[model samples]
Target: MWDRLATDGLAILVIMCLIELIVPSRAKGPVMWGFNLVFSLMLFASTLYYAHFGSVPTYTALRELHQVPQIKGSVESLIEPEYFLFFIDLLVLAILWGVTLSKPKSMRLGRRPVWKIGVAAAGVVSLILSGWYIHNGGKIENEIVQAENLGFLDYQVAAVLKENRQNDEITDGNLGKTKSEVKKLQATFAYKDASSGKGNLQYFGAAKGKNLIIIQMEAFQNFPLHLSLNGQELTPVLNKLAAEGLYFPNFYQQIGQGNTSDAEFMSNTSIYPTGTIAMSTGYGDRELPSLPRLLEKYNYESSTFHVNDVSFWDRSKMYPALNFTHYYDKPSYTNDHFNAFGASDEELYRVGVEKLSELHKQNKPFYAQFVTASSHAPFNVPKDRQRITLPDSLQGTELGDYLTAINYTDYAIGTLVERLKQNGMWDDTALVAYGDHFGILPKLASEEFISSELGIKYNDQVSRYNIPLLIHIPGQSSGKVVERVGGQLDILPTVANIMGVSLAKEGFTAFGHDLLNVDHNIFGMRYYLPTGSFFNDDVLFVPGKGFDDGTAISLKTYEPVTDITKYRADYDYILKLMKLSDAYVKQLPKRGP
Candidate 1:
């Protein structure tokens, strides 16, 4: 309890000092008290955030406060009665101040600079202690563990320091050297058999000259594709698509602070998000090597469609950085009041299909991306939009709302397919659909609750991060379910292979491999999970202090695995790979202003 108080109270104390410095000496007492009360309330808010995200928010997360207004329903639902206790001191101080106001002016104590000196001194001491704690903590790999060791204030300080160090490392590094290191590391891994006479480039250029359409679904998970709720299919359209395409059941999300946008970055560039900040916000000025640039060589026009404002998550800079030829944002679609994003997935697809069809009519091959937002958080669907009926037990619950939203999203895809078919583009298009990240917050959606309700076992982190990846090639009618473990980082190479684009030949550096050809795969994730954590074919391993003290859980069984000795190679490999990815991305030339 004392540790909790010390760690949580630091923010409150810092706020108090700031108030002391700003307010008049005469009003310091009541003002400080009121400010401390507000700080306490913020602490409660942070706790709620931690409970939902399984990590503490740093200073960078504060930049997203402007987004709260858009997600007010979800934000409000996180508040609980216990958070009100933070206001108790404010209530007492208010009464005391009222009573003192009634007393004579002579009865009040005179202001002293000594009190200010003491507060300033305490603040300095707090800073010193925080720095000491962070220094002793060693590496800033796992943010949750770092925060636990150094407290929130110190963790924020450590984050800033670590980010600075990373920037310096990137600025000093050579891209050529990083690429060589990547090549050597990849060569060591036996991705394919050379001695057996099987070419490493199997299925390379399988569907050349095909128009590409990628749908990055928001907060969609793989579990819904195969699961039924109350005898009703949750994602019927996705299920049908899975039946007609290449389905990767073991695919995971590799997003960092950027979330959906990070997924976009990885899927396009196969590079790792720095994990300290949103990739879109941090590296959007870099001349990124991406699919759009690669496709442009083949005379393919690249465009992306999203219902949100182009500036959200700084995508305005990101799209240009990725070298997309065109983009359709909020102004391109009709307002359907679907959610905070304003337009429904159906409308987004309508605009996308029409635009792509126009490009096809001009005899131009296009690479079009559709970012779906109808199934975004709070999972609220308009009455007319909802296509699924929930059982009485889940009527107003988050689970029920999620299913309804997902069902509507699935229904919308059918409309997109119909439009594509009507435009005579269905037979020649190569379609890929995958989720940006996980949706369910573990605090509200417990493992037992999900297992019992959905009749399927769910591991908090493993299953939560697991998302669907379905790629439908033109002229293919039968589906293939590949059991290889993969992440968003693998999407580029995988799609490139099917589209007959050779990354190696183009001198493109990708941190991920082709999920279609690779027999075994491993990917690292550092956003919701710790930096050292990695998922292989067997288990998800998370480090404690270091790899020696780490823990592993079986992906298939969702149970704890005691012996993690076999996964040491994967841990080391993934760490090296992610470091190389960071270096490679940072070394890229900055885009012109």
Candidate 2:
């Protein structure tokens, strides 16, 4: 506490001292007070961001503040009464200022020569101290530790400095060279032999020449796929689909600050999100190589559907950048007031199928992307729209609210499936469904709370991030559960494999591999987890400072792994892969107007 206090106080003192030197004596107090008030709000925002995103937010996060009103339910739920303490000082200041206005008394701090000299000396010392803290903390690769060592305010400054230094180290050029380097890197790294039991070409061309419909579900996780609550099945529609489709139990989310949109970007592009900014806002100017773009060669028309405005998260810019033919958002759907995002998942799919039916009539093979919103955070499904009933014991609980919301979302999917089958499109469509990210927050549903309530073991890190990835190629009879560990980045490659699109022949560069074909897979995660964190087949590795100070947990057992010596190369390889992904995306050519 003292270290953080000293770090925060020193940065404020340096700024205040500088303001005093420039401003008139009478104005100094008021100016410094106003600046401090703004600074306090920044700290409060950072705290709240950490509470929501589980990461120390950078200045880039401020760009997304306009979205707070759209997600008001989730934002309001994040606020605790104690969070208002940040403004208590301002209230006291306001009261004192009102009393002073009656008396007309002035407060000055820079008039005296001695006071000015002391202030300058104090500023120099604070500047030196804060600089030392930033320099030390800035070198740490793990952002969580970096935020701890350097306080919130200084951490932002360090982030800027680090980014500038990195920017200076590289020069932008063709993505071809980067792709070549990526392929060479993958070739050198030792991948686990992936072809002992299954056929080397299993599932290839399984859904060839089929219409593609990818459903990105909101806040969906894997645990509920086959689970029950109070004698009620949580997700019957999804359970049925899982029993008949391809299920990936070891898949996880790889979203950045953009949350849902980031998942969409990574799944389509097979590229890592930089974890510093929303990919839609940051890289939407670039022409992204995506599943839509790949299928366009085969005369497929790609269209995306969401119930919100395209302006949210700048999807207006992203859809075009991804070479999508059409995007149906906001005005395209009927608002049933299902959640803060406006329409229910049922409405989203209903509009999706309606639009897709027109393409089917034209004999066009379409790629339809449906983004669901009914199960968004602060999961409050309207009582009337709810599909499942909760016993009195679980009524108002966070877990209970979540189950209700997802139950409604699942029931909505049954509508889409029936409508597709009615249109004679079910057998001709490649339906891929996956969660955008983790739903349950740690504060509301910790391991102990979940175990007591659900009578199941839950690892906050392992199980919390594990999301479901199911792919249904219409003609397949029985479901196959693939145990390969994968992230959102692998979605495009896996889908491409199923659809018989040869990425190699197309010269398409993908950072992720075919989950079905890869012998052993290891993928990195950041933003939520630290930079060095990764999940391979056996364990999830999270670094504190670096490799030596990191911890690993068994993905299968959810128990701590003591010795991490063998995992060092996987850590080093993921870092290199992500760095290449960052550089590759950064160098992508801007879309022409």
**Candidate 1 lDDT, 345-416, residue by residue in tens:** 999998999899999999899999889999998898999888878898888888878878888888888899
Residue 130, candidate 2: how far off, in angstroms?
1.9
Which consecutive 10 residues in model 1 have the weakest lDDT in total? 106-115
Candidate 1 colliding pairs: 205-500
TM-score of each: 0.91, 0.96
Model 2 alpha-carbon drift over 4 Å, by segment: 91-109, 172-174, 192-200
Q: Please, what's the RMSD in Å of model 1?
A: 2.9
Candidate 1, residue 524: lDDT = 92
lDDT of 2 by residue, 253-366 (tens): 989999999998998899999998899999999999999999999999999999999999999888998989999999998898877788988889888899999999999999
Cα deviation in Å at residue 244, candidate 2?
1.2
lDDT of each: 0.84, 0.88
